[model samples]
Target: MKELICISCPMGCHLQVEGESVENIVVSGNGCVRGIIYAKNEITAPKRMVCGTVKINGATQPVVSVKTKEPIPKEKIFDCLAELNNTTIEAPVSVGDVAIVNVCNTGVDVVVTKGLSKR
Candidate 1:
């Protein structure tokens, strides 16, 4: 059995899950249907949105903001960050430009969140 707080909504439902595996898990204390799905996925394979800064060359700012185009496996966050931290992009980057493609083989792209003009 496991206890978790549902983040699917602002209600923050306290949930109780029980089962040997994700296939048989049961959830309770959910205020809505979304909570059940959230609990199930949270237990089986959790994902998270990643946001960070990467170095920018020939730009007014030393760094630019970036985020994954889609949620990535929770376990791969550190690897993703490490890759991002080691990356350097040229100036005049535009928002929505792909910073890294297929990051960590998760089939997700890291995109620029803030555009930077050339210095």
Candidate 2:
């Protein structure tokens, strides 16, 4: 059995999952159907949205904020960050622009969160 707090809603229902494997898992204490799905997926294959800053060249700011277009596999987060850390983009970037494509081969793009003009 495992205990988790539901993040699917603001209610934050405490959940308990019991099973030997993902297929046989049973979830309880969820107030909504969404919470049950969340718990199951979280336990079997957790994912997370990554947000961070990347260095910019000749930009007004030293770095620009960015985020993954979709949640990535939890384990690949650090690898994704490593790629971002080693990257540098030119100025005149706009919001929603792809900073990195198919990051970590997860088929997710890293996009700029804020526009940055040339210095």
**Model 1 misses residue 2 by how many Å?**
1.2
- How does model 2 score by TM-score? 0.89
Off by over 4 Å in 1: none
lDDT of each: 0.92, 0.92
Per-residue lDDT tens digits of candidate 1, residues 48-114? 8899999999999899999999989999999999999999999999999999999999999999999
lDDT, candidate 2, residue 57?
94
TM-score for each model: 0.87, 0.89
Specify the poorest-scoring 10-residue window by lDDT in model 2.
Answer: 16-25
Q: What lDDT does candidate 2 reach at residue 79?
A: 100
- Residue 68, model 1: Cα distance from true site in angstroms: 1.2
* Predicted structure 1, TM vs. truth: 0.87
